[model samples]
Target: MKDCENLATCGFFRKHLEAKTLACQGFIRQYCQGDKQDDCKRKIYKQQHGVPASDDMLPSGQLLAGHEK
Candidate 1:
């Protein structure tokens, strides 16, 4: 395989690849064996929208805006 000078310009670099950048797939398939499906789906959402669960916030409202689906 040819090396890419800039992966952004490489045709082999797919959009879904960003989802795997944080080792999220392995994290789900391994530690979260029972809830792998939900874990994987959440990771994919985070990758696409850059939204993380705000556990530190108050229960009534969100600190950062993101669609809750």
Candidate 2:
């Protein structure tokens, strides 16, 4: 499956499937906008660690294997 497809099945995504709150909605929106991808290091870290990402986390070039980019 594609990276985004895999992300779609993650527990976090599932939990916020129908949420209208900013955090949940923003996650979906950013993901759809291609902001969360292999090129986005913060997203890669969040996906690997299952942690919530923050604006303070800066982007890097490293990619997390097996994670949705």
Candidate 3:
């Protein structure tokens, strides 16, 4: 999908979900431990599951809508 491709360009959808999740939990990124690829995989997972995020952000309770993860 064009929309998904666009979101992937800057990793906005990818980072936004991670950022939102962290923000929701009040994480301050106090450490430098990194796992960039995993985050991307999450985004892809969200996508394949038909989440509502720009790329694929599962809704609060939908858990990826009608799709299985």
TM-score of each: 0.23, 0.40, 0.20
Global Cα lDDT for candidate 1: 0.33
Q: Candidate 3 on 9-60: residue-level lDDT in tens?
A: 4333345446566532221121111333334443455567765334333322
* Best first by TM-score, ranked: 2, 1, 3
Model 2 misplaced stretches (Cα beyond 4 Å): 1-3, 39-69
- Give the per-residue lDDT of model 2 (tens digit) for 1-69: 134544554444554545455655565556633456455555576678787454333334332233332
Q: What is the lDDT of residue 32 in candidate 3?
A: 14
Whole-model alpha-carbon lDDT for candidate 3:
0.35
lDDT of 1 by residue, 1-69 (tens): 222222243211232234453443343234234333333333344456666323222111223234131
lDDT of each: 0.33, 0.48, 0.35
Candidate closest to the true structure, highest TM-score: 2
Candidate 3 clashes between residue pairs 3 or more apart in a chain or in different chains: 53-57
- Clashes per prediction? 0, 1, 1
Two-way lDDT contest, 1 vs 2, winner? 2
Question: Which candidate has the top score in lDDT?
Answer: 2
